[model samples]
Target: MSKVKGHKSVIFDLRLSTFDACLLMQEKPKVSVTRTRRDSAAKEFSFTADSIPAGGLKDVRAKAWDAFTKFSMPITTDEAWRRTDLRLLPASDFKIPKEGAFEDLPVVPESLLKPLTGEQHGGQITLLPGGSRVDLDPDLVSKGVIFTDIRTAEREHTELLNKLIGTIVKPEDGKFAALASALAGNGVLLYVPKNVQVETPLHSVLWGPGTDLAHFSHLIVYVEDGASVTYVHEAASPNETGHAMHAGIVEIHVGKDANLRFVELQSWGRHVWNFSHERARVERGGNLDWIFGAVGSRLTKNFSDLDLAGEGSVGRMSGFYFTDGTQHLDHDTQQNHLAPHTTSDLLFKGALKGKSRSVWQGMIYVAPGAQKTDGYQANRNLILDEQARADSIPGLEILADDVRCTHGATVGKFEKEPLFYLKSLGIAQAEAERLVVEGFFDPIMQRIPFEGVRERFQQAIQDKLSVDK
Candidate 1:
């Protein structure tokens, strides 16, 4: 709707100090289109227990570890991390998952484990703090579809795994990414061959461990030309006795004329901290649809990107997040158009209650030769309490004169007229409020195709509202 001043104006809604916000933006927000280059090559790195080792990709693990060792944890001084405060985090206390028996792990809830369909759900992958299990459809496997755990895939399909990992969301791209790349031992890898379409959606769940623990995870999906697939990722945690951390990475590669639908649900405990990076690249004529739901987490800082690299490609991103209590969530999103006739649209909405706070910073960049591009991005926030806070920043940079790009952000609350109308229908005040909030998120919730996943989100929303059973 409205364009802020390049990248500077929208970034003003920061929780960091004024001086820090200015330092991070430095006039226009700096965006990394390709691999990030920092001072890390000179540092020495050693392999940990969880370091994945493959035939040809051995060097990748060592290199990523070296970067992580050399890289310093982000602080308020860094521009990308200026708005996110981690002063209380015990960064030095994190340890790589050790090799041992994982059978004694805690039991996860059944609601989180069950899939919507019996076997129609293509597959289900369960990842823990130290172990993972993948069960795919045997019928699909006979047709050349590869869906398995990342470590196993490394041993089997080393060539394909090496080619895609770090190619899109490179290890050196950011601090969190480097950490996940260097040490994450458990992950999922799904590859759909060319011209093959799998109607059923695959699912993955990351269940948290006990207190004061740290886990690194990864999920990589590669869809070949003319192939189509859908994936559902759910992150849930049990109540913790102390602070916990879950740092993860998600990489998606869509080949020419392919299609992929991705869904991610984040619902951790109040003492859990989540930091992750996700990116998707669509080739010529490819299509990518992403749906993200964040209904839990004590504190979260996520950086997600979309790069439309091929002409005639299409990408859409839709997300919803609700923050209550003392929760704090910050998201920095980027959308880049590098080729002609590519289209991208992003819509993210959030609702804050109690003393919770949330910030969203988004940017859209179009390259010089990217003509006839249609791109739009927006973030809308609903603040339900006077103590709650929500900050939205949206911007665009167009080097191509023929491109149509627009961005806007809005911060508001439930209109009194709507509430009054619902109350006039004999609805209780609490029910009326919950109804209005659900209606607000209905648009984005409808984008999720799976019936089971949608119902799970609905239950989470109801829980946040503290609705009666």
Candidate 2:
């Protein structure tokens, strides 16, 4: 492989073979961490078989524990984490929520409990601290659809769960991933059998604990060949003063010719530190549409990746985020074209207010022999306040000479001309600013399949604009 490196970008010419290109793709730069600090932080919480819920997945848990003990927390010195700092996280003060801690479910706020789409979901699941509840349409279930909590799946769908648990996002992906896999009990699973097309969408909500505790959740979505489904997931927490942490994982697999639409909304409380790894793989002729919305958390660092693993596969990612107060949100995304004739597109737009900050780093990679690959990525940021900050980094790595790959990044303040135009029309300054911001996010907002969710996100943006005004 011949390398040509530029600012935040790399281009490689794979003249050897496709296998060689695949091997090189597996190589990642190692980031060193402070061992003493890592060990000190790890000692704060203990994970044992007794602490974890009794069920299957013992081997998976054991492998995850090994990885968790072997890996250390990443530091800011790492390139991917350079823009986000974890020094403010009080790791030693956090405790793992004991089993039965959520025997009586906490009063979830109306905003979180409310349905984003007015229509009823084909299936719905809520994952609390220690327990979960699920409701699915009997017709879908009769059609071989599987939608249930992890515990019940463990008891009933053990073989399938065991086969697909860590295939996409392995425990060794990162330190936090390992930790989540090791203690994963509060989770939901959605499985659609071959050739089944569910007309209605499925929904899942993961509510974080409000206390000074840590929680881990996992999500698996499997769509078999010729199947189609849409899934919406929300991760939220109630406002609290104490510090808390959440480490989660999401794995998605779309079989040959299958179609999957996945939506993820994150609204962690101001006192929570959130870390997660989410990835999706599309097989031959498969299609995937992914939407990400971020508007909460004291600090959030997440990785979202799409792997077009088969020819004729297509993937699209649309993301929008709004940050206010002292919040910090970071997203790292990757579009990997692993097979020929694959297409991928990504666009992420964010707005920052108050003293908040947002970071977006995107990469589009085309493997060798992946000819006819078309990939595009762009990140646009709008800063609403002088103190607010946004960082946009877009990169590309292509090994195929015939592929078309392009990336762009822009970070700018709200344009004065637009605000002035609105103000001259008798709109108030605040209202004018809101209109400008709304227009800036229109492209991404339009991509949202659910109308209610789009309106909810608009209201959230307005709330952020109203803060400290």
Candidate 3:
């Protein structure tokens, strides 16, 4: 398992012990030669605490398996995983998700079998193939609101699950969120207590069934203080092509004067494989609104983050994505403004066709005493096919001496004077390029105020602008 170019990664099937995978490359020897690297893997901190299924937190899962063996995955030496490529994944011959049922998986879709919003929008959770099903609104659980099943709140809410599980995307913070904290086991929890004002809106759906499976999902949202909620998170795949692997973790905590509204949707299946890590933290005078949408998977790498920790906090992030054929979608985003009149805003939009490829990297940070911070970031892309490719990178960093940061990025194609002004009004250059690509994704799907995830993101942009491309 240590042959240079004949590569074998996905951490060589996770049971590490080649001197614990070279312990952080023998202490960061220049991160084992990076710059455009092509295979220099090692950084294992070993995690396999009997694959954790509630065994009294064996000392916090042995420090989350030593932060998933100190973060390791060889996406050619991580420059934010340099343009995502896992050697066209057969990811070390996929394993992990076995405990099958639901009559041996694969067949979902009676439109994802009920509940994609419409229980007056209140509570819902659906993760099938042997586990997960949650339903709420017993008068908001008689007013204390602790929506269930994250291993049943790790056995009846252990003091709010040991103070908010892994405290903001930890588990060595990388290496596929330390392999989703070493194999995620049944997740879903939404607790909105203090000043509770739920007024209907909570939903979750994560599905991964047969064919070479490996699916892990975990979600935690705690909105307290001046509470308010509207949540929805989803991931779906089934209808095999043989090869499935999804790694996920989403953790959000918005307290002091809290209010949170997040709606996320990912449509996986194309012999899926997605790596994920999502985060959020906003305190003093908190408020966060995040809405994101991604079109399926055949290879996706995601990294999302938002931290505006305290003092007049507010964060807004909006995203949209679409790709076709040889799909590969990658996104890395972050907006951090730690305290002092904080504010952060980010926007992302995408489009691609046939020979598919998409990647967006964004960042805006303002720390150092954060005084008067106000940050902004933007990314936009469109390329209908010329062997489609899009990459937008935007960044900004300020060690604040009173900050107001800004960043922007754009990758283009498909703007022939707005498709020749909608084809001189006679419309029909394929319906004026599908109404100019649905008006270029209608302002981030109308800022997603969750009307069933903006009607499944406008029925997935009218089935990719009525295909035929």
Candidate 4:
């Protein structure tokens, strides 16, 4: 029951009376509704003390609340958040899914229940509405491995959780992360003890029902010294479902001489607004590899941040995205080299069709003391139609003299000659287009470490390319 001022936002509904609604501002303070029309009126609501608490970050929440008291809506017009349709995301309209909704839910998708076929993939584990609790094989656990839910792990393994959480992706860094920390209900916790080598991959899935609800989730992983692990985070909404929101945060830590490979896939309902933030840190002699396949969702925003924190650290990331219909997908990534002899490389490619739009903005920064740093970034896009659009922004910032950095971006179309040649071979246009797209994405897909995920990536692309009557 604090006073949070309203701002000059657009009016999507104008038939109600005097605006007096009270809305949650994610991590910000209480937000009040403003008069948009004589008939438009806002309604007031309250949060009970018994509501699911968000205390893991009480101090940070308080500081954010204090800042919210000082700063109100009609936020400073920052370019980073320009594409985000906050008008559709008014906090008042957002709420946690009712517990009863999950009581009698249908069985999980069969695809999820089937055991993973790839070599060393994590087996089936606990799946929930907003979070997951995965039980790693006891054999692996005996070798100093740790895998479980974030909440339980935080309670039982405080030191491991404390040392990794919020360190890679700080909650205060952005509104999405802040909101996720303030409202997230579930998450995954994974730890690989020092010097252990587990060549298998851990997998977790997040499924949301189409109920116009929101589920903020988090994922934290730590690989101790000389250890190795791979992780996959998959998200999807059931077919034909409508209007849902999924906001999530993921953090991965690779300690000295350790290696980590991470993969992420997102396919949500058409009405869902998907916002996710992923961050990773690499220590001395550590190596980090990342792969992402983005599909589905009406509106989506993602950020991937990598920090090379120790000498000789290395990070490599690659992704492929397919967008169709009126969907809007945006990705922003950063690579920060903070130590000497650190290196990082990134490549992202996307294809847009059916009047959709996609944007890619990536940056690489080499600190003043990060001598002998090597960094490279690239973004490439293929536009299939005149109405579909793509945007790319790749930049580099260097304060070190002994660094080698390079950045490039390109947005183009599939070569007509290749298609024509395929047509002459008696191939239909649809099939020909599929060939071109598959080839365009193959470079990155071939590099994916797991065959099962790579096949999923291919299937996603094929699904997007299939034209509907």
Candidate 5:
């Protein structure tokens, strides 16, 4: 694949033999081809409202399935999708496993089981293919905190789930979002009641199914007014030769005067295609701190957004990604200021090696009458090889005359001055490069709240660098 300079356009070659050309000339060519028509694998996969089992969410699934049937997957013509191409994706090869098909759970990686803070988690949930395990501190549960699987919540906390589910991220958001809503059967829910403060962090791990299968997971975090909490989520899978897919969603609600810190780590197998829609809404006087780490997957497209919907609300986002081999990772982010006196800040940093490519598109939007709004966004990328490529686009749209908004983006290679300085100190060339890479990601690493997590990311970076050497 190749990209044009100063534009986010990819050049694809279409090869047709003489017979193919003759057949095309015999019929009127269509202007566009939908995803189902282009992908033979997708034609084999079919779904309807009746396909969903009877449950509290059956209606929700039905509504989403209807929407999914009508909507088509994104194409390069769409403004938001112009930078990425989906023609090479094997959409039909991975089928969603039937309920109760995965009775034997896969072993959880030791790295995932290790504590991120070197202390006990207030609650923990591990989601397998068709089963889940949950653990919560009795003290927190007694205080009205609920941390469990979605199935249990549907049976015990029906009113709460019905009220909050599909509220933050609706099916209308995108095509994959509609599919996820209609098919997702495994998920986690974390609810903190009003005025409750949880000092320990909650953790969740989602392990993908084996080859030729797909896993759709959802996460909901609700912090009521005057409540505070921290949560961490991780998604990963073992390496496999066959294709797989992960379509997921995350919705967060921070109520008035509430505080929440959320961290997400994505490390899918090399044969996986990942797609997700994640969003958070901060109400009046609420605060949200979010961090995202991306390190694996054959191809990924993710959308992350934060809405400052009430006066005095604050939102901050820190993101970091590393790509190698032929991996492609694209992240589209937005920070919207919808109320006066609201503030939002975002920074995304990435490093690319081998033939890998990374794309980052960020925007800061200020709605009308959003006076005293402050918004800022920046993206920086480091290129470690001549064959690697990185694209950064930053934008701003301000309807309010009294708001302040700024955006910046940069893509560059390692500065010779730093390498020379390190070499002058007798540091080996490989070691110097590794140090530079770590320094490039230090700003985002500092924003992580836990020491163990930081060290884990550091180790991951080292491993990537070593492989390159």
Candidate 6:
């Protein structure tokens, strides 16, 4: 793979023996490893490359090894990650699961895996750490569409992979992003040939085994001119308590007149610190839609960036988040209008209960000469308890005098009137709260493209609102 300008490149030769040994390593709390200042009092934890091997096998694995060692990881104190306590993560204890990590882990709960595994989800592929081969749908390959694991892509589509990976989202952008680049391992790459359209959505899963082991993966998607596709990714950890580092990147390119819908769900275990960057570039007349959901993790930092480079292009961004039990979720979003007559819309809703916290920072930029641009952004949050907290910052910058730009945000508890009305109808207080929460989340669900996924998300929100734990 080619290196970026002014950057040195390193390789990780991932081998079975080396990865297995690392996975079995005992958890050793090294909050000091991520410490930014030597004299600081706060505790933090980061993946230690010295504990992982430098070379063994696999070219892509070697690149990951190089990243873990060269890239600067973040300490918990980093402003973006300060709210999510990393000290609780057992990063120091994780090891790569043996060959059985894929099958050994509990069958992914049907509630979560059903939407992704079926033939309707477009195509489904699974990746295993330390060298796992993936099988793709032959029908797609017959259509000249390339959907495979990143490792295979590197070997077969090296030039395309290098041009797209690590370019859209840089690890140096933030602590979480940087860590993902440094530790990237197995991921997926989907390429749609020019003018071809895939009606169904594509699904891929990234599974990291062993306790306290670092899992880094990258996704690179290219939609050639006049092509159409949708992709979904799910990240989760079955083991309850371990320091599993999940850092991943997703880069999408929408060619002229192409259409792409992307969905991502983050459900890393409570003990995991999931950091990711999702971005896309829209060519002239292309269309892009993004649907994101963040539910589980001790702390998560996700950025959604879209660039409208083509005139008359359209983009939509919608997000849903539910945080509880001291969890923290941070989101940074940008809607950039660089061409004339482009339209963009953004809506994000979050509910924080228990001691959980969430932050939404969204911005819109309309460049000069980008007249007739229509841009809108809105964020709403419902705080379910006194201990719950939410922060929303929505802003806009317009250089074109003839542009339509608007942004708004709101943070409040369930409206007392609404709750009372539900209770008066004979609904219990808990049930009343659940109904109100659903009302808050329902509008956003309308934007999801997949009915099956939307149903699951609605049920997830209902469960979160009804349960007190």
Report lDDT (CA) for all predictions: 0.79, 0.84, 0.75, 0.72, 0.84, 0.73
Model 2, poorest ten-residue lDDT window? Answer: 1-10
Decoy 1 TM-score against native: 0.88
TM-score against native, each model:
0.88, 0.90, 0.32, 0.84, 0.90, 0.82
**Cα displacement (Å) at residue 248, model 1:** 1.2
Steric clash pairs (candidate 2): none
lDDT of 5 by residue, 1-469 (tens): 1111222221222223233457678978568855643452223245556655456888888898888887876776666776678776666666776665557545778779667864878888988887788999999999999999887888898889889889999999998898888888889989999999999899999988588787888899999999999998999998788888898999999999999999899989889889999999999999999989899899899999999998999999999899988899999898988999999989899999999989887877777777788887888899998888887777776667676666677788868889999999999998998899999999998888789788878987987888752
Tens digits of lDDT, candidate 2, 1-469 = 1223232334632222223346678968899866665543323345554555568987788888888888766776567777787866776676676666776546556566566765778988988887778999999999999999999999999999999899999988998898889888889888999999998889888888567788889999999999999888999987788889999999999999999989899988889999999999999999999999999889999999999999999999999899988999999898999999999989899999889988887878888788888888888899888998887767778777677777777778778998888889999999998888899999998888789789878998898888882
Clashing pairs in 1: 24-79
| Candidates 2 and 4, the one with greater lDDT | 2
Arranged by TM-score with the best first, the candidates are: 2, 5, 1, 4, 6, 3
Candidate 4 lDDT, 437-460, residue by residue in tens: 988887787778677877888888
Task: Mark the 10 consecutive residues where model 3 has the least summed lDDT.
Answer: 1-10
Error of 4 at 238 (Å): 1.9
- For TM-score, candidate 4 versus 6, the one ahead is 4
Alpha-carbon lDDT of model 1: 0.79
Considering every candidate listed, which one attains the maximal lDDT? 2
Better of 1 and 2 by lDDT: 2
Runs with alpha carbons beyond 4 Å of true place in candidate 5: 1-53, 99-105
Clashing pairs in 3: 44-69, 45-69, 46-69, 267-296
Best by TM-score: 2
lDDT of 3: 0.75
